[model samples]
Each structure stands twice: as C-alpha cells, then as structure tokens.
Target: MANAFYKVPQPVNEPILNYRSGSPERKALKEALAAYKKEALDLPMYINGEWVSTDNKVAIHPPHEKKHVLAHFSKGGSDHVNAAIDAALAAQPAWERMPWQDRAAVFLKAADLISGPYRARMNAATMLGQSKNVYQAEIDCVAELADFLRFNVQYMTEIYQQQPNSSPTVWNRMEYRPLEGFVFAITPFNFTAIAGNLPAAPAMMGNVVVWKPAETQIFAAKLVMEIFHEAGLPAGVINLIYTDGPMAGDIVFSHADFAGLHFTGSTKVFQALWSMVGKNISKYRSYPRIVGETGGKDFVVAHPSADAVQVAVGLARGAFEYQGQKCSAASRAYLPESLWPAIKEKLVADLATFKMGTVEDFSNFINAVIDERSFDKISSYLAQAKKDDGVEIVAGGNCDKSEGYFVEPTVLLVKDPHYRTMEEEIFGPVLTIYVYPDAEFDTMLEQVDSTSPYALTGSIFARERSVINYVTDKLSNAAGNFYINDKPTGAVVGQQPFGGARGSGTNDKAGSVLNLYRWISPRTIKENFVTPKDYRYPFLEEA
Candidate 1:
C-alpha cells in the first residue's frame, strides 16, 4: 500500500481544561513558555557598522506572564546611541547619492531574502518574543515585512518618476533631492513589520537610518539586521540598536546631523520626543522631520441588516488577534438595540469557542500579551471595571500570569454609553459593548466621536445603503483608517495608507506615498537648457 499523507495539525477545540491540562502539544507549549521565562536568547546592539555586545541585560517576558523572562536583551547606553547617530551621519551622503534604481534593487533583494527561510524564523520569533498568535505572527513579522519592502520600492519608484505637468517647457528639467542628513526611528513591539518599514522607508530614499527597537521584541529586530546584511545592504547605511528610552532621546536631540525621526509607540513617547526637538530647535542646522503613529481606540458599529456571522468573526479576530495589542484593534463596539442581543449572543458563543493557547498551537485563537507591563495594564483595567457602576463583564475576566503574560479574552457591557470603560484605550483582548437605541443612531455616532480622544480606526457593518453612506460621512474623520463590513486591520502596503490623526499622532500614513514624501526633501532642480549667458526670458532683462 502507498504511504498516506500526514497533514499538519489544524487548531481545534478539545476539552483541554486549564493551561495545565492539554494534550502533548499543549504540554510542550507550557514547557517552552517555562523555559523562555528563565532562559532567553542574548541579543546584540548594532552601532557605527559594528555589532557590540553589552554587559548590561534586561529581561523579556512572554505576554502570558510577567515573571517569566523569555529573553535577555543587551541594553546600550548613550555612547552607543551617539555612535549610531554619527554612523548614520557619515553614511547619509553616499546613500543619498546612489542611483535610485540601485537603492530600489537593494530593497527588493532584501525583501526577497527576508521572505525566504528568514521569513519562517521571523514568524517563530514573533510568536515567542512578542506573544502573537500564528496568523498574526505570520502576517505582521514575515509576510507583512516582505510586502512592505517590495511594494515600497516598486510604488515609490513609480511615484518618484510620475511627477506631473512638465509638458510644453521647451528648456526645463526637474529633479528631487534627498534629505540632507540622517533619519532616526523608534518602533514598538506590537508589529515588527512596522519597525522594519519605519527605517527602511527612509533608508530606501537614500537617507541613512538609526533605529531603536523596543526591548520587548529585540530578538526579532536583530533578525532584521541579519537579514538586511545577508541581502548585501552596506554597513552603516542602516544601523539597529537596542537601548532604553532616555538614551534614545539624548542621541536624537543632540545630533545636529539628525534630519528626522519615524516613530511608532505610545503617545507619551512621541510627546517627549517632540519636546526634545523643540529644545534643540535653535541648535539644529535644518528643520527636523518628526513623524509618529501612536495609540488608538478603534470601534465597530453594527446595524440590524448586518450579517451577524461576519460581524462576529471580524470582531473576534480584530479583538483577539495579537491579543488585542494593535493600535488598530477593535476595543469598543456599538450595536443597535434592535440587533444588540443577537450580536451579543453570537459574540459570546464565538468567544467561548475560541481556543486559547501558545503560538505553537496552530489551532490556538489567542496568544499571550507582549510583556508584564501589558499584563499589569490589562489586569488593572479589569480591576477598575469591577468597580464601575455601569460596567459588567460579559465574557472573560480571568487572568493567569504564572507562566506567561496571558489574559483570557474579555468583553465588557456598559449600561451607559458614557462610562469610563467606553472612553479609555484598554489595549488588550478586552472589548467594551454598548447598545444604542434604534432612534438614536445619529446621537450614538456623535457619542462615539466625542468619547474617543483618539481617532485611529473604526468599522461600520450594515447592508443598508443609507446606513453605510451616513456612517461613512460622519465617521470619516473618526479614524485615519476606517473599514466597511470588515475589521480595521490588515492594510496593504501600497494601496492603503496607515496611521491616525488626533491623539493617535501625526498622520504620516506609514506605507503611503505621503510617508515616502516625508523621508525626502523635495528640491526642484530646474535646469535651464538654454545657456544663462546666451539666452534670456521675455520677462527678464537681457544679460
């Protein structure tokens, strides 16, 4: 008889009791989580074309638990940060002067290399280091990284050449200039892809980059450095460093050669960086660019005609994917009173059926949070919800941080739409639901706009034409990225711009043409074909 094909195991719901009581797969995940807590890969910091090993170490925890150290990351001081800045300064001119086609080729090769074997390892690292689920890890760290590089190069090359309205100029030529100096980048752990592109975007445009990746995801960031180098990127063109926040601040502000910063993190961090820029405003040789994408409190609105199955699945994936740590994750939902009970029933049923396990468990729907800080924050939010008069836990309210930074998927129902639970950004697998009276549709939208200090992202689910049109117009400004009948994540690199306005930081939409524009300083090099001494314009006096 022919040998049978052994297919890979798909994620399924078994009667696995708690974290301790599952099959051998679950047992292995537990073991890995336990081992990672105590023993982690030692990551290096890069600067000035050298990978420096540091003696000082910091602990990394799987989001399932805070006490467990998933990895030990090397921490660099101000000296290292300054060295990277200097390296970026030295490399900027050459990188800028390189032909655009060459730069595009380099990034394209890098993307291909990353998507190969490097892609698998990257996905695994994201799962362990950042506590992302299988699909989330695959997309954000591996797939999305490749896409960001490839599309940025292809689309940017096209945009660079597609400048408009040069016709009928008998003796005129136009050219664009790269920024004068180095670009600095500070990225977060939520999406390693964002970290890669924040600096890659500027570097591809001929600017040298100094990147400070979040300590939580240092190992993955280090992998990026390895992949770029393997792809033949010149040393000093893109420098990656691991450091504390203050050290990063000192370097970016003190370096007179620094031209810009591409940041994705908390709003507080952006504010502090902005303050430093202001302090050094007079000392800098040129105006520095500060582009940021901070926090968000995204929403979802459901109308009666909306497909309950579709909305439930989208909301479940949006709320629980990456353990709801994304800036675009849906944390709040508004359901019309007529459809509220049915939606609630489906959501609860979906939530109950979701299998929560380690990323190694391909069937697992939700993985751990990123770190202990995330656990504490989400835990604190739940504690606060217990005391809130109008808030009730509709789904999960339990947390287990003994082995990893893990919190069960949680849903909160608010009796009053104006409750605190509805306003704050509870960045985790926590969703707050509120019912809107059918007659109060307009009023509810106004409430959504007013309640959220952040206007990062929101979704509307309705089959009715009028409902869709009305919500789109009213909530247009509600999110930098708004969705219709879909979850507010998975934005493609070239087609849709990413980033948010209001408290979500500067609207420098990450993968869009607008973002590429930020990386370059447009200098209109108008070349006059006619010799200046031999020819003169009709409006000017003859030389």
Candidate 2:
C-alpha cells in the first residue's frame, strides 16, 4: 500500500549535559545510580518480543566495585541461539514489508525516549556496569546513543529516496530492498551506544537482527532492549540473546539464512568470523555482507612549532580517558626532542591531579579497565616496561586489583620509536612516548606510517600551515579519522563518520549513508509502455 511521499524529522546531535555541582541532572543521576545498586536484577534475553529466561545465570559486577553484584543475566546455549535465529527469519518478511515511514517512527520514538525519560537510568547503568564516570556515561549511553538512533533514521530516508531515470516511453525504478535474511550484530563492552547502533542500524533498514552484546556490558544492554520495546518496536524485529561466542557462531555462520553481519570488536575475532563465513559461503542463500570496526594503535604527533602545553593536554586527555578503553584512544606519541622537556613537565603535572577510584566519586578522572582479563594484560605490559632498559617509566606505573581492576595511567618513554608498546595495541591507560630529533620530522612521519599495521585515528599538532599540510599529506594512509590540533577520539556522528582500514576495519563509515548501503540489496526495474507487434528491430525491418 503506497501513498504520498513522507519526510522524517531532521536529526540534530543531542546536547551533552555537564553534571555540575548540585545540578538537577547530577542529583537525578545520583538517585538513579543508588537505585540500581540497591537491587540485584535478574535479566533475561529478548526473543520474539518475549523475555526468555534460563536456569543458567551469570552474575554481573561493576568493574570498579567487583564485590557488589549489580545483576545476573540468564545465559543460554545452542537451543536459544537457534530460537533467536528462527524468530528473526520468521519476522523478516513482515518487517521488511512494512512502510518505511512506520519503521522510521519506531526508532525516532526510541531516540526521544532515551533523550527524555530513560536518560538517567541508561547513564547510570553504563556508569556502574561498564565502570565509566558520569561524564563518559552521559556522552555514551544517553547523548551518543540518541544521536545514533536519530541520525540513522535520517540516513535511511536518504537511501530510499534514490531512484533511476526514466524516458517518455518507459519507466525505470530502483528499489532498495532489505537483505535476504537476518543480520547478526555483535557488540562490544566499551560502548553502550555502539551496542545499540550495531543492531539498530541494520534493523532500521528493514532487516531483522539477532544481537549479541558482550557479557560485561549486558547490565546496560538490558536497558537498551527495554527502551526499544517501550518505543513500540515490533515483535521479533530485534532479538537479543546471551550465549557463548563459539556456540552462537557455530550455528549462525552455518545456517542457510545467514545474510549479513554488523560487528564491533577485536580485529582477531572479526578475522576469525570472516574465515568461518568464507568456509561456509556456499551454504547461504546469498553472499553475506560483513561490516566491522576493530582495534586501533592510535597516535599523536607533535611538530617543533606546536605548543608544549597543548601537546601535554592532548596526551593526558586522549590517552587516559575512560581508562583508555576507546578504540580511538591515543596509545602512542612522537614528540620532538626540543619540546620533550616542557611536554613532560606539563604531562606529569596533569597526571598528578587525576583521581582514580570508583565512578561514584565525581572528581575521579580515571577508573578501572573493563575486567580482570584486561587488567592482567595491561599489568603485564607495565611489568615488561619496568624491566626493559630501553624504556623509562615517566609517570604513574601502579597496578592494584584487591577490590577492583585498576591500573594507574602509566607513561613509558622509549628510546626506540619502533618499540613493541608503540606498535602493538595495549588497550588500557598506557601511553608510550618516543622523543625524536626535531629535524627528522619527515622521517618520523614515515616511521609512524610503517610502525603499526592499524590505520584507525591519529592527530598532528603544528602551528605553521606548511608543516600542517606536509604532515597531513605524509600521514594520509596512517589514520582514517585524522585531526590537525585536536585529540583523535570523540568523533561525533554525522560530523566525522568513524571507521578505519588496513588492519583496523572495512572503513564502512558508520553513522553515514555508506554503512546503511551494506544492509540493502538493490534491484532496478524497467517497464515498457508500448510493445512491438513483431519481434524485429528498426535495422531488421527495411534498411
């Protein structure tokens, strides 16, 4: 049933709220956090619009306060995964056939709900569950999640409006249809917004989804499912499940209805999934669309002309925020020897003022890493750096996990630019600095490009316009989202579409129309207004 053309409401980025002292938002957020901590919730999986529970329960704990049990989620096995896939496939036809405007309305309502009534709860969940400070939680769980939902609806409209040209005698049209089967969305623990976006993006494009969120993130992810339901999302459109990765992959990848994958996780896991898909390609109905955003060894480079204070602030904020869990976090830096002394002074001074503790304390700038596994990995790196004569610990090299998994924001000054910590990904609050001669800036740029297999995010600081231009061009392939004088993190949706290439990801540019294009299969149709009586052309007639 087709009617008049409709337009969705224009999307604007949600304003970030600063939880100032005694502010209403701060008080409300405090109450929400206290309320969540008072009760230990029993969470369940959402399949076919039903909350499915099992006897197998996994306790969820705050990364910074491991003694407190926040929630316990029901974990399922192969049967539940099969049920989720079956539900998605069964729901696919009705969902894809619905009017695009109606589908857009569901997500738009979800955005409004997140922005208004559910904002505090969502933020609180993220703060306690993922061990994020209030500021980080507000930006991620509330503002960024709402932005993704709203902006994605706008992107979907732009996609459907595209059509082909037609002549007077014939009519042509291009129909953007949803992929043949369900999409598998595998989300990570670091970002609640990403968890929502990975599944919601594909589902908004008229495709059904089976979403699997990270175990550490399910505490907040359960709230995401609730918000979607309250927004009037239809049954089975998006089915959230909790199962072991290998068990789920074994069933999903081998199924005939496997159509597409929207993933945000480690690069190695993405590669393994791709390999599995390739081996089972012949079993599927159509070629599955694989889109992923993976790891980053992000960098920050400073020119001799760059201000020392600004460089220090960039390194402090870019490398240590959110315990350096962000994929785009600056893990390595190249500072000119001329500016090293001043930069080091300011950086150390700034690190001295950072308070590390649980998220309940608003003043703490640093918090725990995601879990014990991350803590061990980061601690091992710190231990190695301490013993290595080639590197010197400049500031904050402490690890304590008696109550929570916490590693102090550690800095390593390495003599060699190609040291292991500089090239490899240590996804914690550890920033490695290498001081190079000021005259060898170009050589350093070349080394930067070759140092890491990742091309995620990077920043170059320079006052001179020529130096800026020269470095920008030289490091063209070094990063996907490059900055001139700012930190490489905090890429806003619609402003800087985020992704990377080489070893990082497919660079599909999430939050843009480009990522939406992957979820659709286009078909061009041509209709002839008049038919020829005889099977003959003008050349065959009477030339």
Strongest candidate by lDDT = 2
Compared with the true structure, what per-residue lDDT tens digits does model 1 show for residues 1-543? 325432212212111122334554335444544454445677777776677888998876655545545677778888888788778877777778877767777877777776655555666677777877656776687667777787777656655775545434343434556677788888898898998898899888888988988887786788888888777677789888887788678867877777898999988788988999999888787899999999898999887778877888888888887788899999988888788777778889989988886776667788788777778899998988888788889899888887777788999999888777678877898998998888888888898888888989889999998989999999888999999999987776655678899999899887767888887777655544543574667879767
Q: For residues 24-127, could you state the per-residue lDDT of candidate 2 as single tens digits?
A: 99999999999999999999999999999999999999999999999999998999999999999999989999998889889999999998999889999999
TM value for model 2: 0.99
Poorly placed runs, candidate 1 (over 4 Å): 1-40, 65-70, 163-170, 532-543
The model with the greatest TM-score is 2
lDDT of each: 0.79, 0.94
Return the TM-score for candidate 1, rounded to 2 decimals: 0.89
TM-score of each: 0.89, 0.99
- Give the lowest summed-lDDT range of ten residues in model 1: 8-17
